[model samples]
Target chain A: MSRLLESFRIALRGLVANKVRAALTMLGIIIGVAAVIALVSIGEGFSAYVSGELEGLGTRTLFVWTNRDAANPQQLTTADAEALADPLACPGIEAVAPAYQQGATATYAGIETSPNVSGVTPEYLTVQSYDMKVGRFIEQDDVDHRGRVAVLGSTPASDLFPGSAYPIGETIRLNDVPFEVIGVMAEKGSTGPMDNDDVVLIPLTTAQTRLFTVDTVRGDYVVSSINVLVQSEDMLDSTIEDVSAVLRERHRIQPGDTDDFQVRNPSDMVETVTGITTTLTIFLGAIAAISLLVGGIGIMNIMLVSVTERTREIGLRKAVGAGKSDILWQFLIEAVVMSLIGGLLGIGLGTAISQIAGSALDMQTVVSVNSVGLAFGFSAAVGVFFGIYPAMRAANLHPIDALRYE
Target chain B: MIEPVIDVRDLTKVYQMGEVEVHALRGVSMQVMPGEMVAIMGPSGSGKSTLMNMLGCLDTPTSGEYYLEGAAVSDLNDQGLTSIRRHKVGFVFQTYNLLSRTSALANVEIPLIYGGVPRRQRRQRAIEALEMVGLGDRLHHQPNELSGGEQQRVAVARSLASEPAIILADEPTGNLDTRSGKEVMAVFQQLNRERGITVILVTHDPDIARHAQRIIWVRDGLVERAEQVGDRILADDSQGSEEDKGQAVAVAALDASGTFEEVAS
Candidate 1:
């Protein structure tokens, strides 16, 4: 222990003797560690942003959209929407809503706006992941009675009624027909390329009959397409497959005939997002790891110079009875100390940069404690790995030659 | 009457630089008794430094036997040689090779540290060593802050800290001013006389060699002459008396500078 302490003192003295050189050497490691932390944090933030986008799409919602059959333009119907609600055939199916969308001009007072009008039942609130901010959404009674009541999404309501004192319970004319606004949806941001909070909703029957005015309704009346809400994420895939098979049978489509409907499971969205985030993390970690490599190389280069500069000292210590292991350990300790300091500095810089980026870019910057651990561990490992050659060179030096060195 | 502390028989050291084999020591034999102060003197390239290195166990002889206090040193491996150096021999360099950034106390304590001494004990011993060399107050002073004489004194103190049987100094006063050189030589004399530590100094200066009771002159890698001085500059009667009584004739002849001619005859 005394010998080790003496060695440490000697190593510190050697480093202190060349102040500018030592600081410059440490600079390489510092930059390397800082780069690792900053790059990895940025990558982490990007991944979180993507994952948050996927989460906004809803957890247990399954989307069924119309796949136009070129051969038969009139394909999906109300019967297909009703089949999804059957408890036996499609187990764990929570609720189903038939949706029909049409672009139309909405007018209130002097304002005129073209909004995408969606026709849906009360269950459409659950399937589309809409939450009411004021008033109520379409109820079962409204759907049964084919009421001409409407729900305004935050964007359309704000646009048409721009600071109006009354929005909910106020009547808005859709294509010259008056419909009472029953509810206004809360802000839902946006989902990738689509804005969910921009549309207006009314009962499916009212939208199909009053808005579009196609009596036979063709394939578009299957309420544009059925929205199947599953009870949980675990039942999603099977429910989607069951619904697809039933729809195929109902529409009498042959195998591989390009069905007149499309089945979309929400879990696929989650899985796709998870895969992307994992890849992003790995990619970011790899780029960050390059800094560690550069830092290790810096350590090696500095240690080599240290060994050369301390040749006479090594000789003197050996002449005074220090063994080869002693010389090796002294140089090794210097390298380790340099790297450890760099690692700590890197952690601090990385965390600060991540916080700044998180707020400035409006991204989720999650700095993992494990990443700190990994960074420190990597720094120490780099110290050891880079320290070896210099330590060996010091140890291998002959006391005679070392003593003779000027 | 006492067995020699160091025994060398037919020792030779050859240095090969590229193709030339320079014979530094060629079939030289000598003995140094315990507590004896000896000086080896020769001109440049006369192989005095080579002999000193071999005696200090810092280098191995190309051929011959060397025994330190009865243990054979010539056959010992590098680790064994280090142990011999740590426990049985200490060295002072001409340049006073104290670690540049270290304090005098730390420099002196290093040998003891390698000997596995505990920190407290090493500290105490280092202080005592420095005190003995008259530099106890300068313990915290680094080599750069110290005078050439003080630096050499610190090196001498380091040599004494390990309590080795012999201190091999290669031109201990070479880099110092005359006054400081004399001061350093005085410390070496004191260590030899009072502590009964053997001192073997290499020098070409007759004035520096005058401090030792016995002087060995080397030329062309061989011992040209060996002589004893009758009156050693020490208050310790034991070392002076023992050296005087045993080789009185040799000492008398060397005191007159006639011993070299007699040995050549």
Candidate 2:
């Protein structure tokens, strides 16, 4: 035990004697570890952000879309949505909202902006979990009577009426057709390609008859997509099966034939996003790990030089009765101490950088405990691995030859 | 008669340099009694350094019988040799060989550390060893902080810290001025005379060799002569004569006649 302590003291003194070299050697390890921590946090934060966005869209929700790649693609309509909404047809379904959408310019008092105009029924607000900032949403009476009433999402509301807090009861023209804005949606922010607040919602009847005027060969009104809300998370799979069966029957899809529609669970998108981000984190970490490998090589290089420089010292120690293992331990402990100190400093710098980036870039970054532990552990392993060769070289020197070294 | 502290018979050391085999030592036979101060004198390439290395247990002879403290150490492995060195052997070098930037006390403690001496005892023994060499006040001085003579004394203190049975010093004063050389030789002589520690000095300088009671002349890897010095000079330049002065003159005559076995007998 005392021998080991003496080795540590000797190693510390060795480092202190050449402070600039020691610090430079440790810099490689510090930068490598810091990069690993910072890049990994960025990747983790991005995945977290994606999951949060998915959560806001609701976990118990499923999207239904027409399979345009099918041999005989069928248009989705409000009738199909109403059929799926029947409690006996799809027992686990809580609500169904079929929406038809088109890009159109909305103008108010000579101010115009292009927004996604969606035609939806009263159930749309409930299915999408959107809240109103003012006035009321579309009612069943509005859909039945083809009322020219509208609800504006916060983006278009603010764009068309900047500085105006009360956008409700204002008359706006969509694609040159006039409609009254009865309500404005609360702000929900944007993510990726879809802007949740850049929209205007109107009654389906008015959209199908007045604006788009598109009718199928069988005289059925068409919609772009349908949003279905399950009663609970556990009922999602069975509810999808029920909805698929009902839709296949309505579209007259034959057995063994591909269906003309798709049912997508939002949770699957969350899993995909998580997988992509995790792989990205590993890739960035691997690149940073290359720098660590180089740092280990630097340690080995310096240790070899040290052994050569201290040849006479080693010989004198041997002459004074030190064994091979003692010499080995002294050099090995020196390398380990250096790398561990570097690991600690790197952790501090990494966390600080990540926190700075988190605030500077307006993105969330998480420096997890697991990552810090892994980085520190990896640096120590690097020390041991690289220190062995040089330590062995020092230990194996013939005492006579070492003593005679000039 | 008491057993000799160091006994070597026909020691041969061959060095394999690339393809040529260079013989460093050839059938060298010698012995030294306990508490004896001996000097092995040789020119460069005369194998005195190799002989010193063998005596110090830092290298093994190619083929020989070496009994140190009456134990045959000729065939011992590296571990056994290390243990023997730690317990029975000490070495001093021409360069002082003190660890640079280390305190004199710490330098002395190095051998004891390797010997696994307990911390408190190691410190106490190091201090005593330093004080023995009259470096009592210089215990905390580093090698650079000390004069050439003081550094050599510190090295001597280091060698004495483990209390080994024998010390092999290679040109103990090769790098020192005459006064510093005498000072270091004084410490060695004091240790040998007072502590009964056997000392072997290897040097090419006849003046340095004159300090030992016996001188073994080595040439061409062979023992050319082994004879007692007529008048040995103490480290303080005081001259003294041995009781075996008549026997030494006879040995010197036999060496002149090339009858080496008669001197050994």
Candidate 3:
């Protein structure tokens, strides 16, 4: 320990001897470490942003859409929805809400606006992960009785019912027929290319009978899209398979013929998106790691210069009975110290940069503790790796030659 | 009757500079007893430095038997040579080679550090060594802060710090003024007389050589003459001794007459 302390003192003295040169040499290391941290953090933030956007899609929700024969363009129906909701055939399937969407004009207080209106069951809120801020979603009684009721998303509610005190319970005319607003959905931020909280919801029966009135609905009453809620995430695959099999049999598709419905597993979507994010994070990390490599090279360069500058000192120490290992360790310690300092400074700078980016750009920046560990570990390894040549040079110097050096 | 502290028998040193070999020490043999003060006097290029280097264990002779306190130093490796240099010899270079950045006290403590002395004990010993050389007040002063005389004194103190059996000084007073040279010579004489440290000094100055109890004059890598002064003269009736005595008397008379040719002859 004393020898180690003495080595530190000697190294410090060497650095002190050439203050400007040493500080300048440390600059490369500092910048490199900081770059590693900052780049990785930003990459992490980007990935986090992507994952949070995916989470907006909700968990345990499955999307069943019509698998159009690119040649045929077939739509799904209410019969397919009923088959998907069969409890005995598809156990653990919670609720099946079929959706039909159409662009239609909504009127309130002499003002008219065209918005996308979706017809769905009450279970649609849970399946699509919607929370109502005021009033209630379209219920089973509303669907059975074909009541002329509607639910507004936050944006459409404000747009259609301007100056109204709480748009809920107000009547909004869809295509000139008055429908009472039963609920207003809470705001859901943009996910990828979709603004989820910018539309209207009404009972499927009401939308079918009043809005797009066709008594004997053809093709699919469900309008080619259905949202399925499974009892748990673990039962999702089986539920999808069960739903697909029932839809195929209902559509009368023979074996080897393409089915008319497409099952989109939300978990699979999450996995694919998460995989992409993870890969992107790693790619960014690898780029950031280049800075670390540069930092290591900087350490090695500085150590080599130090060895050259302290050649006489090394000789003196050896002449005074210090062994080869002692000289080696002294130089090695100096390199390690330099790299560690750089690593720590980099981490601090990186975190600060990440925080600034998170607030300024409205990104979700997450600094994992493991990344810190990895950065430090990498710095230490760099110290050892870069220190080897200089340490060897110092250790190999002859005492006599060193003493003779001016 | 004391054992010889340094015993060199037919020591020869050859230096290979490119292709030509320079025989620095062709064949040199000598002995210095404990407490003896000996001076090696020669002209420039007389190989005095090479001989001094060998005695200091800083260089090995090409072929020789050098028994320093009965241990063979000629065959020792680098580490062994370092041990011999550290524990058995203290060297005072003509240039007063003190580390410029270190204080006088710290410079004196260097050998003790190499000797594995603990910090506190080494400091105390260094201070005592400085005091012995009358530089106790200049302990904290660096080599550049001190005069040539004081720096040499610090070097002397450093030599004494290890408590070695032999003090090897290569022109210890060469760089000093007359007064400082006398002062340094006085210290060397005192140390030899009081501490019983064997002193072997190399010098081209005859005045400096006069301070030693014995003088070994070297010419062309050979010990040309050895003279014992003070109390080593023996009362003898041998013819060769009588002739040497007559020559000595004639030289003394010429010195009284102040005749350059007579003294030179």
Candidate 4:
């Protein structure tokens, strides 16, 4: 124990004698550890943000879209959507909303902006978990009567009316077709690649007959997609199966053939995106780990140089009765001390950098305890791994040859 | 009869220099009784340094039986040789070999540290060793802060701290001037006479060789002759007697002139 303490003192003195070289060697480890922490924190924050966005829509919600890649492409209709709402047909399903959408420029007071013009029923708000900001959403009476009424999402409302004037009771033009704006929706924000707030909602009947007229193949209006809200989170999988069965029967898909439509669970998408993001995080960490590998090499390089420089010292110590293990431990401890100190400083610097970046980018950054432990442990391992060769080189030197080293 | 401090019989050392074998020592035999100060003198390549290394336990002889303080050393393993060196042998080098940035006291404590001496006892012994070499006041000074002779004295103190049975000095004052060399020799002689410690000096200088009670001459890897000096030169006028106060004053005077004469001469 006393000999070990003495070796520590000797190692410390050796490092202190060459301050610049020692500090430079430690810089490699510092940068490597810092990069690992900062990049990982940012990556973790991104995945968390995406998961939160997906959770906002509710886990029980599922989206069904027409699959254009099917051998016989099928179009989803309002009739098929209505059929899914039958309680006996889909007991797990609570509500369903059918929607058709087209991108067009919206104009009010000569200000023009692009927004998705969507035709949806009143149940769209319930199924999508959206609340009204001021006035009521589209009702069944408006669809039956084919009333030229519209509801503005928060983004289109702001775009059409830059001033704080009430958007209700105002007339807006969509693709040169005028419609009365009856209500302004609350903010739903954006998720993935689609912006929920950049939309203008109208009655299904009015949009099909007046603005976007299509040839009636089966005397039914077609919708782009259908959103189904399940009764509970636990019933979501059964509800998706129920909806898939309904759509498959409606599209006349054969038992041996693939379905012409796809039912998507929002939670599944969250899992997949989270998986991708986690992979991205690990890839970033591995890239940072390459720098750590280089840092280990740097330590090895410096230790080798130190061994060569202190050959005479090694000889002198051996002459004074220091054993091989003593010399080996001395050099090994010096290397570990350098890397461990660098790891600590890197953690502090990395945490600070991540916090600053998080606030600047307006995103959450998490510096988990696991990442800190991993980085610290890895740096120590690197010290031991790299320190071995040089320490052995020093220990194995014949005392006479070492003393004679010029 | 007192057992000899060192006993060697037909010791030989052969070095493999790539494709050639160089016989450095060939069947050398010698012994030194306890408390005797002896010098091994030879020109370069005469195996004097190799013999010193063998005696110091830094290297094992290729062939023969050797014993240090009555224990057989020729067949010991590396660990045993290190243990023998730690407990029974202390080495002083031509270059002083003190750690450059370390204090004189710390340098002196190194051998004791390797010997696993307790910290307090190590410090006490180191201080005593420094005072033994007349450098009690220079303990905290680094090798760079002290003169060449002072550094050599620190090295001597380092060797003495372990309380080894024998001190092997290889050209101990080679780097110092005549004054520092005489001071170092005086320290060795005083340690031999007062503490009854056995000391061996390896040098080619006749002036340095004459300070020892006996001289062993080596030529071409073999001992040429062994002789006793009729009139040996005392390194200092106050060396033969126990005069601590007078020796301190003389050391103080030498300390003042220690660095000056080396630069001038």
User: 2 or 3: which has the higher lDDT?
Assistant: 2
Compose the digit string of candidate 2's lDDT tens values, residues A1-406.
8789988988998999999999998998898888888888888888898877776777899999999889989899878988999999999999999999999999989999999999999999988888999989999999999999999999999999899878888899999999999999899776446888999999998898998876663677998999999999999999999999999999999999998999998897888888998899899999988988898888889999999999999988888888999999999998988888888898888889889988887789999999999999999999999998999999999888998899
TM-score of B-chain for each predicted structure, in order: 0.89, 0.90, 0.87, 0.86
Interface RMSD of each: 1.4, 1.0, 3.6, 0.9
The Cα local distance difference test for each model comes to 0.82, 0.87, 0.78, 0.86
Clashing pairs in 2: none
The most accurate candidate by DockQ is 2
* Per-residue lDDT over A1-406 for candidate 3, one digit per residue giving the tens place of the 0 to 100 score: 6556666866676667677776766666667666667667777787767767777776788888877663453567777787778898789799998988887898888877777888888888888888888898899999999898999987788787677648777888888878998888888777666778778888887787778853343644656488899999888888888887887777777788787778887557767887887787788778778878987888898889778877876765554445666688889988887778778887888788878878888887777787888888888888899998899999888764665666
DockQ, candidate no. 2? 0.70
Candidate 3 Cα misplacement greater than 4 A, ranges: A66-75, A102-107, A110-116, A132-134, A144-146, A155-167, A175-177, A186-196, A205-218, A222-224, A244-262, B1-97, B109-122, B162-187, B199-265
Q: Write the per-residue lDDT of candidate 4 for residues B15-54, one digit (tens) a residue.
A: 9999999999987777777787889998899998999999
TM-score of 3: 0.79
Q: Could you estimate the TM-score for every candidate?
A: 0.86, 0.87, 0.79, 0.86
Winner on TM-score (3 vs 4): 4
Which 10-residue window in model 1 chain A sums to the lowest lDDT?
A: A214-223
lDDT digits (tens) for residues A1-406 of candidate 4: 8788988988888889899999999999999999999989988988998998887767888899988888987788998899999999999988999988888888888999999988888889898877789887999999898888999999988888888647788888988899998989889888777899999999987887887874453888888889998999999888888888888888888898988888888899999999999999999999999998899899999999999999999999998989999999999999988898888888888889889989998899999999899999999999999998999999999899999999
DockQ of every candidate = 0.58, 0.70, 0.16, 0.61
Which 10-residue window of candidate 2 chain B scores lowest in summed lDDT? B233-242
Best by lDDT: 2
Q: TM-score winner among the candidates?
A: 2
Q: Model 4 chain A, poorest ten-residue lDDT window?
A: A208-217
Off by over 4 Å in 4: A87-91, A103-115, A133-186, A210-215, A232-241, A254-258, B117-123, B144-147, B223-225, B228-265
Tens-digit lDDT track of model 3 for B1-265: 3456788877888888899999988777776666778889988788887888889877789997899988888999877877876788888878776776879998887777667677799899999999999998999999999999999999899888989988999999999998999899999988887787888899978888889877777777777666655332221213224335442421221122111111212
